[model samples]
Target chain A: MFPGPSAKCARLGHFLFLRSLTTEATCAVTRTPTLPVKQATRPQKSDKTSISTAIVLNRAPILTRSSTPFETAYYSYQARIRRALHNPFPYDFYFKQGTLIETRFNLEERKRERLAFGPAFLSKEDVSEEKRAADIAAVEQLAQQEGEGEVLMPRTHPSDTSGDVRSLDRKGQRNLYLLLHVLENGKETWRFPLGKVEKGQFLHQAAQKDLYAECGDEMDTWVVGKAPIGVYKPRQTSAEAQQASEIVFLFKAHIMAGQVKPQGDHIEDFAWLTKEEIKMRVHSHYWDGIKDILSDH
Target chain B: MSMQVASQAARHSLTRFQRAPKITRKLRRHPKTGLPTPHVKIVTREFAPSRLEEHYHTTLKDDLMYMTYKHEIGERPPPRQIRMTFDPEDPYSKYRHNAPVGGSQFHKKPAPSSSPDNVVRLEKIQLHTMVKEAVANKSQLLSAIMQMKALTGETFQGGGHHAVEGIQIVRAKKSVGGWIRPNVPVGVKVDLKGQAMYDFLGTLVEFVLPRLRDFNGIILPPQSSSIKTPSSVSGVVSFGLPPSALVFFPQIEVNVDAYPKLAGMHIHFVTNAIGVGAQDRARALVSGFQIPFLRR
Candidate 1:
C-alpha cells in the first residue's frame, strides 16, 4: 500500500528529478520533428560531418517522478552495503567441467541473440582514447543527424501494435547504443534487457536471449564476449519480496547493422541513450554501483 | 591450439599414402615330441585405416564400377590396391616417420567417448611487474626479481618485448624534465604454466581476486567473439592487476617486508579451442571451475 503524505512528497520529488532529465530528451525529439520511423531505410549525412550531428535525440523523454531524499539515500546506501557483502566465488566454488547444464531452447535462444545482436564495441579494447571518443561521437552524430525515416524500418501491419512486429524491424541500421528503459506503471527506470535464467541456461546465454527478445534481429546488437559486465540484484516489490529475487546481467552490445524493434508489450518503451545520458538518467542507487562500468565505455 | 593444428596436418599426410605394416613370426613345440617344430608361421599386421580413407575407397570403387557399366565394356580390372609392407631398415623412414607410438596426443584424453568437461584446463598464470626505477639502478632489478619470485614461487623471466615504452614517467619538477627513454626493459615477468598455473588460478580466483580492494572479477564482453565463426584472437579476456590491489594476495601480504616497491601488471586469458561455439565452450569450461566472470 502507498505511504501517506510523506510517500506522496517522495513521489513528487522523484517526478521533479525526472522532469529535469526529460528536458534533454524533449529537446532531442523536437529537433527532429519531421523525422519519422519509416525514413530509417535511407542513408543520411556522413558521420564524419560532426557539426550537424549534435545530440538531437528527442525520443521518449522522461517525466519527473516523486521520491524523498531520505528514500534515495536509503536505497543508495542499501545498494552499497549489498555490494560490499556480495561474494561471487562462494557459490561458484564447486565448479566442475560440463556441470553447466544448458537447455536446447535456451542455447538456441542465446545463439539467435548473438547472431542478431552483432559484435560489441568495447570502450577499452581498441587502443587510443581519442579514437574511441571519436567513434562514440560519430555513432551519436549518426543517430542524431539521420532523419527518423532514414533509420526506421517501415511499420508492418496497422493491426500489430503490441506483438512481435516491432522486433522484426530489421533494416539498414547503423551502430548505436541500445538502452531499454522500463516505465513500469509510470515509474521511470532504466534497466538493460534481462530475464530469468531458464532451466539449463548459462547466465550469459540468458542475457543474450533477453537482449535479442527486446531488440529483434538487429545486427551487432548481440553480446559475443563470453563474459558479463556486472551482476545486479534488483530490489523486490512488497508483493514479490518473499519470492526469489532476479539477478540482472548487463552486456555491452553495438548495432553493427540492421535496426531493432520491440517484441511484446512487457516493456513500456525503449530508447537509445548516449553513455553520458544513461549516466544522468539512471536512478541514483543504480548509477552509484554501475558508474565504474559505464565510465569504461 | 598449435597442437591441434599439428595433429590435423599429420592426419592429412597419413591418409595420402599406404601405411607401413608389421610382421610377426612364432614357433610352437610339438604337443607329443617335447621339441621345437621345424614349421614356421608368419603373421602380418596393418594399421587401421582412417575413416576418411575407407569412405574415399568406397566412393572411388563406385565411380569405377559406374564407368565400366556405362561403357558396357569387357572385364574391367580391379582398382589398384597398394600393399603396405613394414621394413625396419627402410631408408624412407628418414623422410617419413611412422605415427608416434601409443594413443595420439590429440586423442580425446582419458577416454574418447567420455564427456570432455575437464579437458579445458588452466594452462598458465603469468605475473608481470614493471619497475621503472630498475632501469636506473641494476640492483633494483635484481631486488624486483627476487620479490616476484618470492611471491610467485617461480623464477622470474627477463624483459618484455614492447614497442615504444608503454609507460611514461613525467618529472613534475621540470628541473628533472623530459620523459624516460622509450622501449626500455623496465619490467620482469614469470609465466606459471602446467600445474603451477592451476595452483595460482585457484589462489587468485578463490582468495586474492575476491579480496582485492575495489576489485571486481574479470568481465568477458559478449561482443568479443561470435559463436557462429570464431576468430583466432576471439574470447580473450584481459584485465589489469593494480599495484594497490596486489598487496591483498595472501603470499604478498604476509611477506610485505620483501617488497619495497609495487608494480602493476596485465592478465590475459586466451580461450581458443576446436569446433563451432568454441568461445562459449571455453568460457563455460572456465566458469565451471569457479572463476566468476564479471559481466561488463
Candidate 2:
C-alpha cells in the first residue's frame, strides 16, 4: 500500500517528470488523474523523490487499485465514514413490486392486441372518449364566454384595456400552484407539471415547459422559480408507467403573467391548489416525503 | 302493460329465490338398500333468517350489474407466495430497481419506496483546498493553513500539507514577477466526512451560494463529462470558489480578523452513485434539494 500523502506525493513527482518530458512545451495541458490525485509536487532530479518513486513503481498496481478516491479516500483512510444520514436503515428485505408494471413476456403482443381490438371489445372506452371530448368542448366554450367577461375578474396588469387575463381571489398574490391531472383508465389523478427533460434541457426547464403546456392559455402569467420546491414520485398506473420510473421535480412557480385556464387535451382538468389541497386531492401514499413542501406554504 | 308485468314477475322471482331459506343437508343414503333415506340433522339459522336474506337480496338487487360483472370476471385467486427473484423483465416480478439509474425517462423509483430511502443520496461532502506555492511565497504557509482551518473548522491533515505542482505550464507574465517553477509547497487542505461534511454543505448551499451578489448558479457538467470517471460524476463537478467569495464562507466570515491572507477552495459534493445512470440520478437528486444548476 502507498504509505501516505508524503510517499504518494514523492511518487507523483517522478510520474510528472516522465509525463512533462513527453508533452510539447507549454501546451496548456489538462491532466485528469485516473486515480484521485492526493497531492503532487514538481519533480527535480532529486534522490529523496527518486527513492520514493522506486517504492511506488514496485507497488504501482496496488497504489492505483487501492487508492482511496481523493474525495472519499480520507474518510476511508481514517475509517471515519459514517452511515449516510438519510435513509440510514437498510432497504426492504423482500422485494415488493408495489405498483410497478408486472412485466409480461408478451408485452408487445398484449400492447398490439389492446391497440387493435381493445376498443372493439371495450366499446365503453370509445363512447367515453367521445363523451369526454364533447364535455371538454363544452367546457372550452364556457371558458371562452368567461374569458369574454375578463373585466369581471381582477386584473393584475393595467397598462391598456384587453380583458384576456383571469382575475385572482387575491390580486398579485400567487401562493397557489397550477396542478395538472392526467386521465388514466378514466380516472383523473393529480400530478405536478412534469414531462421528460429534453435532450438539452434541465429538470427545471422541463417543469417550466410542462407547466405551460398543461396550463394552456394562462401560461404567460406563471413565472417559473429557480429552486425546486420538492421532488415527488407520483404513483404509477399500469398504463403511462415505464420500465424506469421518473421523478416529478416540482418547481415553486406562481401565476406571474396570465389567467388560469385548462390548456392541454391530455389534461382532464387543472386546478390551483395549495399544498394542503394537493394533499387532500392526491393519494395519501404519494404524499409521504412531500410533507416538507406542504409546510412551506 | 306486458313489459311492466314481465319485469315485475322477474323481480318477484329473483327476490323470492334470494330471500327464501333452503335446507342445508342432503339425505343420507342407506348403503345396504341402495336407496336414499334421510339420516343426518339439518343445519338451521338461529338469527332472523328472513331479515338477513332480505338484506342480501336488497343489496344484490341494488348492485346487480356490478355483482354480475364481478362474477363474470371470475374470482382472482390470492397472489401466490413464491420465491422472489431479481429479474426486471418478469411481470409480477418483485425485483425492484431501487438503485438509481441514468437517463431522463425513469421517474417511478420512489413508488415502491420513499425518498432519501428511494432516491440517490448525497453520501459525503468533500472539501479540496489547493494553495499555489507562488501565492504561499507572498504569504506564509502558516497563514494559509490558519485560513483553511478557520474556513472549514477542521484541522488540516493529509495531502494538503504537501505543496501542489502546476500540472500545466503558465506563460511568462508580469503578474507572477517571473517564470513559475513546478515544485513548491503552496498550502494545506483537509477532507471532511460524516456530520462535519454535512454541516458545511448545508451552510454553503443554503447561505453562502445565495449570499454571493454576482452568483448566478453552479454549472453541472453534462453526462459526457462524467463518461471517464464512471464512479464519481458528482465529485467531478467541483464547486469553484473565486477569491472574492473567500470571506463569505461562514467559517471565514466569523473569523475574518484571525488571518490576513484568504485563499479560494473548491468544494466537491461526492455522491456514492455506483454507475453512470445512478450518477445521473444522483445529480438529479441533488438538484432537487434546491441546489440550482446552470445549464451548460
Number of the predicted model whose TM-score against the real structure is largest: 2
Chain B TM-score list for all models: 0.45, 0.46
Candidate 1 local lDDT, A1-297, one digit each (tens): 542332333343345446545644554565574865533543221111000000111111111122344444444443333332323322121223222222222234344433322223112244478854665565555546654235543434232343432232311121123456666667877656655544444444555676666657544543433344444555556345323223455544434455556676766666554456567767877666555544221
Task: Enumerate the candidates' DockQ scores in order.
Answer: 0.01, 0.01
Roughly what TM-score does model 1 have, to 2 decimal places?
Answer: 0.27
A289 in model 1: Cα distance from truth in Å? 50
lDDT of each: 0.45, 0.44
After aligning candidate 1 to the native by TM-score, how far in Å is the CA of B231 from where it should be?
Answer: 7.8
| Model 2, residue B179: C-alpha shift (Å) | 15
